[model samples]
Target chain A: MRVLALLDGTPADPDAPLIRVDDLGLLRGDGVFETILVVGGEPRELGPHLDRLARSAAMLDMPEPDLAAFRRAVDLVLGTWSGGPEIAVKLVFTRGVEGGDGTPTGFALGMDISPKVIAQRAGGISAVTLERGIEPGLAERAPWLLLGAKSLSYAVNMAALREAERRGADEVVFTTSSGSVLEGPTSTLVLARGRTLTTPPSTLGILPGTTQAALFRAAERAGWSVEVAPVDVAELYPADGVFLVSSVRKITRVHTLDGKALPDSTGLHTVLDGLYESEY
Target chain B: MRVLALLDGTPADPDAPLIRVDDLGLLRGDGVFETILVVGGEPRELGPHLDRLARSAAMLDMPEPDLAAFRRAVDLVLGTWSGGPEIAVKLVFTRGVEGGDGTPTGFALGMDISPKVIAQRAGGISAVTLERGIEPGLAERAPWLLLGAKSLSYAVNMAALREAERRGADEVVFTTSSGSVLEGPTSTLVLARGRTLTTPPSTLGILPGTTQAALFRAAERAGWSVEVAPVDVAELYPADGVFLVSSVRKITRVHTLDGKALPDSTGLHTVLDGLYESEY
Candidate 1:
């Protein structure tokens, strides 16, 4: 079977079967995953990505893996064939095969070639706010269950993106049923109100973003206000600027929401670009 | 590295590596995983496991894997592996690896040797209810995010179970602070009152368990009433009989919870044991 293999930053053979699962993704959605973007032949924000990976691994009950080994593996790929343009890097982990005898089969890990680069919307993505569709307060109570950690079991986020795609938009800006804005499916939602850049608190079960964290620091250093607060979807469209931030696509501006066009903001682009320069 | 390989159910070399993630499980936690028990040389209830894996894969936005080969792999192992009273089987999948050009590397998969089975418990598991600690109604709202599907991102469930185990019980029974019961880390809660067998509704975001579904069928054929409804942790100590059901151990009678021993209901045990019967 042909398979897509992602080593570090380069794309590999597509026909080699590289993965097999009993559909653990279907059975329990019992894993965490990561997506890193490669730009100019380098992985962006490796430190933050590793930090988030550690946080996510702790959430899944696995021992913290050797970070040095992880770095080495990525470095190994980098030292070999590099595309040097742009590409998506995917990382996935399961609980390992478990049950019956209560023993662990080793974990299945793989890299996949993804969209070389997200289509950069000329202005930004138009998004719709769904009620987040989750039971209230459970994410907080089950925080230890790794609510904020990026897991391989990302059905809804995938669906949200699909929903966005369906709506002819780039992504969904998740909101509580009660109307509080959460974040995007794959990226952290940051609002630029004049000069202040704000995102939902990670404590609220949004997976902490290495890219967003770095951007916030850069924003603060750039003398831009950065806040982590509860945001309402209703107010998002009117914000001076709105964007999605992640390790791969450092910042993608939002163009429209619910068919309504949003105003332009270059301030966010400036701060985020500086962050990209220093990191990626 | 040594690995016990099973293609469907057939056994292969043990001293060789059938898959390698380069320890990707340590990197991004990017994969889906499952564990099945070998019963009398036959794999128990594999269809449900594959289904769960598919659901999780969809959640991760990976292509749906063809599980037909998995069934054959299990058969391959059962046809070989020759030694065991009973054993556990593990299956895992990753996104494969990527190259320095930012493409996916080959995928890695491995089957683990069974762990020693030592089912020990005097009684049922006791759970402490946390209010799910997040926004209200997140589970009901966000079904797409896989509140109920089993995913490898189980760091928190393991922690929750560890927390429960630390408190002197078997597994953690998760509940929303709203007073609605979710489920245990790994098993679904089955309770009985007289001849009535009951569990929680999946609308609450619990992974639909194949074992539980089989139990429901078994209970009804045995002329016991079966009901799937919302349950709270408080209902446990008062149930006539309680047991946690999974693929491997089949059924383990819960003995003590929060130091309080639950009463033995012949009805519960009868149904529990009856479930293993090939004709139940």
Candidate 2:
């Protein structure tokens, strides 16, 4: 797998030493990142992802990233890579080496999406509800907890996925201590009920889903109502359909949640998939 | 300023590209770390730090690290660095590149501890109370959240320290959502009331402090009573004294909490300092 880095403006060798050992991003996970889906050499939802990355940086109080630099790097990478009608492009900004000037270390890398991820999306995924172990309303009051930021500190998310795999499930839907459905490890939760599409609010400490927002707009235009509400984990079992959505995965149907088969909604998946592909 | 990577049993060049971009440690912040203080070319409390690292790795469900390899790396880094009766030694282990066999990527680096940190030990520091935004007992029930483990996913901890710095304080004592005193961002909260030195329990999602444990044993030997109990944020202001203890920092007194002066306890500092130095 080929890679590239944007340590100082233009793309550099990914094989060289690009990061310092004391970089807080590597040491303390003090950073933010966004993953974009590149199809046919065009980055999907670039603006939204960049916007979210900026917001995440702002929340962390790190330097706002050089978006122009990021764009140039992304373009350089996508243009250079030969094998990708579907590539995953990741943009990362870390609070540089500890005790430095705090200038953010920024980089981007493009890789081909795995055949397994693509297959999981096509066949849908079985998910389990795991306890996120955070209260519902605490993040709104304590922003320093970085609940709304897409920080690189995702050890718990990876552990939850490992637990799911141990349980023979493919993915996870994390719920709050109060049992409110939060979001996925690397995706957002979206549920369809009748003619309305709903997602949990970012106010509840979940990162606002960029693709979910785009889908909501498209659904609104497609004669479906869109709502952001507090969704309980129980609501997922009876919904018309449930999806784990993200920029890269696009949208994956949750065929079974916690070993129970969710209602079949292939028709809903088809409609939303078309809307996501075209809208983004 | 030097570093080394024990990628596969040998100390590899730190200047070389030893990590893949897809390394879960870099990609997902999925890893465990230990920061040890080296004095006179020997790692202080090496055994406890390694034990904690193993426990943290287990908590993350990554492969158990090769302790023998780790010791060799530490010895090599310390031997290579010429400076220091005081050096900061770091051990890091990531779950390796994604889509791989989950072999762990391990490395060690030695650097001089900043003079400011050494001074903070003697001059003491002003601190503030920040909400950890987690409940007290949730971590014990939900190990996947990885609260007790010193996982590398510490973005929130860094953010809280930034907030404290923004508020003109040197450190933070994180309280739970319910206002129970938890621990410092990187240190354990230890309070003195009368002759008893008390610390919050690890059951409250706090990382058990290796230094604090050694201090407690030494304190008992030095004729001070030691206890582990639940402490509220309210108790910090009225205590005889309050401190943040860690392996690298040793013990740092909290001169103030949220702009309120904590009672002076120079005698406690002196006693604990002697105990810490001699015990280690």
Q: Pick the candidate with the highest TM-score.
A: 2
Error of 1 at A106 (Å): 12
Stretches of candidate 2 above 4 Å error?
A: A5-17, B1-18
* Candidate topping lDDT: 2
lDDT of 2 by residue, B131-222 (tens): 88668668877778898898889999988999999999999999977789999999998999988999989988888898999989898988
Fnat of the models, one by one?
0.24, 0.65
For candidate 1, the per-residue lDDT at B161 reads: 66
Q: Write the per-residue lDDT of candidate 1 for residues B1-280, one digit (tens) a residue.
A: 2224443444555433343443232234444566676667666677778888777666655567558766666665555555655656666554444232322221213343423224332233444543433333465665445576554545556567666755766566667666766666777778777778788887777767667778878778867899998776778778887777766546666766667777865455655676655442
Candidate 2 local lDDT, A1-280, one digit each (tens): 5667584657676655556656778888889999988888888889989999999999999898889889888888887888858889899888887777877778888877888789988899999999887677788878899997999999998889988999999999999878899999999999999989999999989999988998988899989999999999989999999999988888889999999999998888999999877784
Q: TM-score of predicted model 1?
A: 0.76
lDDT of 1 at B20: 41
Task: Give the local distance difference test score of model 2.
Answer: 0.86
Deviation in Å, model 1, residue A50 alpha carbon: 3.9
Give lDDT tens digits, candidate 1, residues A1-84: 112334233334433333333333323454555666656557777777777777786776656655565565555544553454
